[model samples]
Target chain A: MGKRVGIEVSIAIADAVKLARADVIAAYPITPQTHIVEHLSEIVANGELDAEFITVESEHAAMSCCCGSSAAGARTYTATSSQGLALMSEILYHPGPMRLPIVMTVANRALAAPISIWNDHQDIMAQRDIGWIQTFAENGQEAVDLTLHAFRVAEDRKVSLPMIVNIDGFTLSHVIEPIVIPDQEEVDAYLPAFKPRVRLDVKKPVTMGPVGIPEVYTEAKMAHNEAIKASKRVILQGWKEFAEIFGREYNPVETYRSEDAEVLLVTMGSISETAMSAVDAMRDKGASVGLVRIRLWRPFPGPEFRKAAGKASVLAVIDRCLPPGAVCGPVGAELRSLFYKMPGAPKIFSFVAGLGGRDVTVERFEEIVDKARAYAKKRPTELYEVIGVREI
Target chain B: MAQIDAIVGWKDLPFGCHVYEPGSTAKFRTGDWRSQRPVLDKEKCIKCGMCWVFCPDMCYSQTEEGYFEANMEYCKGCGICAHECPKDAITMVPEED
Candidate 1:
């Protein structure tokens, strides 16, 4: 094992950008996410990383610049969070459909009503259907590792879906931890420079984003769907390759103490750490429980998730945001579709928790599990349960 | 009016407005002209008037709630209404040639 060193998550991301040898970077400043671009800017300015770092007026333009650069066959990167991400939501779907492998770092932050700048999954969760490969890192080290691997996974010919690597705002982005800075020679050997077979080459004119008629419109969407489905194999392959080089492990879905447990708790992002401690406490008290963390949200690992939650009597899904008038958060809705036909698939209990950066303590996780256990005993009434709210 | 002998040389038409030789490249291929007409879901439409306003050839009639029936006589099946419908109530599917 390598000796551990303390480093902030922002610097870790900058170091990953350097290792990835990103050809072009364009970003706008936003809280929590700002430090990452700032560090990258300094690196570019100091001539440490030879890349075109363009500062744009807004997040939408930032993404637009990425689209142009990636289309020109460059390894592109960017960072944003919260309102910045929401602002760029439209263009986010365009790059993937065009099959440009642009990697981005989103410092996960809470959405606004009054306004907030704290850590939450609401921003990235809202972008679930944007056709991007999404991953959540629990800490700074994972953030750097995943960000580097995202480029490799995305540019793979089998899976040309763009990827978003998410680290919690302030929590992971500003925090420090030991990150193994991979040697440039090693990274160059691991992640070869992007050489697109198809690009916007003026020598050979080809159409892109053309208005397709009925004869071809559905075909375009179907192609994108199939490409994403194909990405599953690419993700596993990328993980295997990354492990071979770095000796670090990664999976689409991660389980902690999940074996021989009747009850399982599901969550994502930074809250998994909290959930783990809660599961440990519950186990110490002789409770039959475990935790399953969903690392990849998009290209949702339905089959893998089913295998992970095998034979559990009750599956409690915890989400950080509400879908308002819907049965549960988006994650719960996606999970429910996976087991609609299976017999004895276990009763799924959806719980909404940790909105607007609220503290999700160990006691709260246990309370959610207890409520879910009670509900599973009765006839299923509703598909969702709102946790940690005072009902009048 | 003077002497209606024969309407020849009109076969060089492009949009069926004229006539031309069968094998000529300038002649229209009727096979390519057939395409799907746009269908509107009136129930989900919110009187946005976007479809009517955005029709490139003004083929859509403005109804009180939304655009009225598409005029197939002039409708080229361009699908501008389908693309511009913000509510996604308009759909275009293939029609028999």
Candidate 2:
């Protein structure tokens, strides 16, 4: 393993992009996510990384510039948080259908109405169906590793899809952790220089993102769908190679001590670490408890997730983001769909917790496991419950 | 107007629907939408090329006699050519004429 050093997660991600040798980075400043671009701008200014740093006006322009740069055969990158991501969402859909392999680091934050600058999955959840290959990082190490993994899978000739690495804002982004920054030669050995299959060259003069008429729109969309689905093979392949190179492993649906557990805690992002500790505590007390964290969000690892959670009788699914007036939280809803009508399927108990930088402590996770076990015997009144919401 | 020749299955479609063929735009003959056509009078034309320059769709092309004529295949009957004619040499005639 490489020498580990204590560094801020956001800064570590910036360093990861630098190691990827991205050709272009265009971004706007937003909270939690600002540190990443700030560090990157300095890297560009200091000439440590030979890359174009475009200080764009808005997140919209940041993404549009990414599309343009990627189309022109530049290895493009960008980063943003909640409102910034919401603003750039229209252009966000373009890169997917346009097949631009631009990588972005999203510092997941709560969306505003009452206004908040804190950590949550709501920001990324809003863009769930945008057709980008999305991944959630459980810690700073995963954040750094996933950033590099994103560039590799996204730029792969078979994939060529945009990717978003989601790190919970403030919770994961602001914290300083001991991270092993990979060597330049190691990164080079793992990820080769970008070879764009198609590019905007005057000699070629090919049209890109052209107006797809009704006759061709469905076909075009179908092709994009197939391409994204096929990308999973390459995604896994990249991760396998990454594990071989770095001696660190990653999976779509990662499990911890879930072999014979009756109750499983399902979580994503930084909260998974806390959930793990909770599971350990429960196991010490002789309770059957385990943890399953979702690493890949888009092109969701259905088979892997099903296999991991199949043995458990009850699932205490935790969602950091709550979509109002839904049957359950997004992750809850997805899990329901996964196990729906399956024989001997686990009973899912959805819990909404840790919204807008709220702490999802070990005690809260223990409570979820107990509640999931209690509720599995009988259906709860409400489909999903919001934990720690004091009605005052 | 003919639709894009995209009747093939999803697998046959290009990645991201990127049109790699050169001059692919030439396939869409937009002139079918033209309700009125530009009728040019060779006698009054001074060969000033105003119609060609003023054409929004690049529909006007100069003939061997130096008279600018609207290519009906791509012309959208915008009437800019007739309106911009310095000598009033062009008239917007309905397609029936």
Candidate 3:
């Protein structure tokens, strides 16, 4: 057991990486994600952590370096946000099929055209199909816990995939919160030393990332797809082991007051906490409303999500990112596709609420619920509704 | 056809972007794609090793008597060896196919 200390979430994440005993860290500085790698550099410089801290010139190079390090059988890590993540996109798709279990932290931030450094899901949402296992943390504590869990799941022999833990940019990354910083011994017990099933070694050389001609390309992709899907079991196992050791339970799709509710608000990332507060307020007003937070995004946990939201009559899916020109926002569109063929599926109302760090207050959530109820009562209309946009 | 059949099933292929054997490109036999081949004139050879250095595929190797010869197993007959040979000991000729 370790003492509960109040620290910034970025520092807590750096501490988690240190506890996990990552062997290599290659990162480029970017807003909101800078503090995490800065603290990690300090730890490495102070000799508290024995790791190779590479200060790369760009996010592209940082991810490339991480790929090289992880392929060389070193437990590797990196952190980025917004444009840094976008810049790394070129090399981001390499680690998954290469089966390098490198863990990264993504401080979710808004993409720039007008250039705002703030919290949003647009950054991570744009990278949804890169073949990495993705998870969202609603608060600072989960950010710390999931950082540790990301390594455990990624390094599992069955999973052998890369993973990203997304924490909302200024909201969760810069905020101070009380978190339990687990001791090294407990973390060592929970996450064993990473033993790569295959690696680049001089004594036993093996070719990795070889060109896949057309004959084998589809098979290669199929193998990568099946690996990520099968990783759901390993993820659950890691969370189960984490609960036994830390006494904090986690699920792929976690529900709040959704056991008996007619209207459900679905959210990911830090907005889930605010949505939960809104759920409490609505419950006080004798409204059967609840919250469903998607903690795991990749390999989507479709069965778990279906079971959790199946009983609801009306589902309001609040998307933080605006998928322009699409029928609905990204998360909402995904949910619609998932529930379209489902038996007795709830009437899903897609709402794009927060974009570019726009505040999604409890009042906004209440309004979302009201609009969903209204749409459910009326005839079926548009596929999605963009809320909070001022008429200009 | 047997080789193609072996890889048609998912179980036969290596999992997840792997090349199970190191240096397995040797088995590809790129010489089959060659249209022009470099013939070495051993009588006029000075063995400056320029052909070996300039070979795009590095297919030229030193012989026991210190003369350069193409391995032909992986050479694509690019003719860089013939073009770059300082001693004029190599000439590119059309292959019989």
Candidate 4:
């Protein structure tokens, strides 16, 4: 173990990135995500980290370079935010299905069209179906811890899926916090050198990036799906190992005060901390409210949710991004489907709030509980509702 | 089933053969082979040597008449020499196989 340091979460994440010792990094600069790569660039330039950092023109090229590096059997890392992430949308689907575990950091930001550069869930929401294992950090400490664990989990043999460790744009990315910095030897021992089962090598000729016909395309997709679905165990195992060394625990979905609560709020990314504070305040007032923070979003913790939602009365689902024309937000839709097998499950209500970095206060969360309670009285549960926005 | 040279209808299509078999060697066959064919305009032949110098793959050679000719065997159909010709001497045209 090395000395502890007081640093910003973004810097701490950069330090962890150094410890991982990636062979290649292809990235473009975007706000909030800039500090992470900037620090990494300094490390590489100052000779602290030995790696090839290719500064590409756009996010598309950044992802394209990562695809090339991973195909060449090198451990790769890249960081981007908001628009940069959107630019790489085309190549996002290739890595996971191809089973190349390139780790990435997505400083969560709102999507454009009044063109806001602030934090929100819109960027990641757009890529929900891209097949990457998604995870969110509640604060800077989790941000650093998750960044290191993400590489281990993604590279696990069962889950060769690319991972996106999302921290809030500005909130967690820019905030400084105390963190334990492990020595390089400790990290090397923890994360062994990655040996890709299949890589592009001239010594052994292999065909890659080939176009597949419809006859075998579905099978390839199914294999990718099964690999990610099986990755849950690998993810837990990696966390267990990390816990042994650092004493930090992780799960797909982490529950806070949900053991005896009547109402539960489910969310992802940095909003969980805000939601947790609200839960604590509400609990003090004798309101039986709790939170289900989804740290892993891609292979969503379905079985765990079924266990956590055991007997809660009303489940208030919150989403930062709107899935237009759908009954509820994305997380809400996924959670509702998990309880379809139960005969008597709690009534579920959806809320779309905190978009474009808008403030989601404790009062707003309490109001959502009230709405869920009211909606439960009526037998027919309307699927989703936008929380703060009012109709004219 | 009877073997046929060419199919005029769906009835002659092969059945039960998987297209994505491990050793499937099916290649895209086209009748109009020359999706791009280089043409030389004799009137505009200045022979500046720009096209030959700019070709990354050196697929062009000089004809006895001092004009450039494209070697189809080595040309990967990049169209760079034709597009970069200073005299507009090279033109691409489609040809039938």
**Candidate 3 TM-score versus the reference:** 0.88
RMSD of 3: 3.8
Global CA lDDT of candidate 2, please? 0.91
lDDT of 4 by residue, A1-392 (tens): 66677898888888999999988989899997999999999989999998999999999999999988987888899999988999999999889878789999999999888898788888999888999988899988788888889888877766677999999998889988787887788788778787776777777756655554444455566667777788889888988998877777888788999987899988887778878888989899998998888888878878887787768888999998887787778888887888776787877888889988888888888888777777888754457877788677
Judged by TM-score relative to the true structure, which candidate is superior, 3 or 4?
A: 3
True contacts kept of each: 0.00, 0.88, 0.62, 0.00
Best by TM-score: 2
lDDT of 3 by residue, A112-195 (tens): 987979888888888989999999999999999999999999999899999999999989999999999998889999999999
lDDT of 1 by residue, B1-97 (tens): 1111222232221111111233222122223353888888888787777888888766678765445667665566788888988898888878863
Task: Give residue A191's lDDT in candidate 1 (0 to 100).
Answer: 92
lDDT of model 3, residue A215 = 61
For each candidate in turn, the interface RMSD (Å) is 17.3, 1.9, 2.8, 12.0
RMSD for each of the candidates: 12.3, 3.2, 3.8, 8.2
- Stretches > 4 Å off in candidate 4: A379-382, A390-392, B1-97
State the lDDT of candidate 2 residue by residue for A159-275, as single tens digits. Answer: 999999999898889999999999988889989888988999998887899987666788888888888888999999999999999999989999999999999999998899988
- Stretches of candidate 3 off by over 4 Å are B1-8, B26-97
For residue A328, model 2's alpha carbon misses the true position, in angstroms, by 2.0
Candidates 1 onward: DockQ, in order:
0.03, 0.55, 0.39, 0.04
How high is the lDDT of residue A139 in model 1?
A: 84
Which is the leading candidate under DockQ?
Answer: 2
In model 4, the Cα lDDT at residue A28 comes to 92
